[model samples]
Target: MPIGRADVSPPHWRKSSYSNGSGGACIEVADNLPHTIPVRDSKNPTRTPLLFTPDAWASFVTAVAIGRLAD
Candidate 1:
């Protein structure tokens, strides 16, 4: 689901630790909502965010943790 500014409540956005603070490849995630994980570009806060299901998000994170996404 696409999340517009008005579609979501106040989001507590957390930046990725891998972000070097160089204004490059930075993404923010808000997982406080039930059943959905919202992701947005850190540089473009005004834009709509992409929403992921909890299961999909967990699988993606697990793949990243195991370095399977690199292949």
Candidate 2:
């Protein structure tokens, strides 16, 4: 049997630690993909996930952690 495109695995999405059970605002991230991290709104999983390179993702995470990107 030939392998099909749809046979590919889907991303394993995890909610951000900062997210709360109330669901006011939340984003899920898939860190399983090689060299890529995908993020999407938890309330809208069917939407296209935003892809980020490993390095870029790392930098963005660091900035957020240190409050450089905070409002």
Which candidate achieves the best TM-score against the true structure?
A: 2
CA lDDT of each prediction against the hidden true structure: 0.84, 0.84
Q: What does candidate 1's lDDT look like per residue over 2-70, in tens digits?
A: 555333567789998866778998999998887678999999987999989889999988998899988
lDDT of 2 by residue, 1-71 (tens): 23442224578999999677898679999888766689999999899989898799999999999999997
* Candidate 1 accuracy as TM-score: 0.80
Q: Ten-residue segment with the worst summed lDDT in candidate 2? A: 1-10
Over all chains combined, what TM-score does candidate 2 have? Answer: 0.81
lDDT of 2 at 41: 94
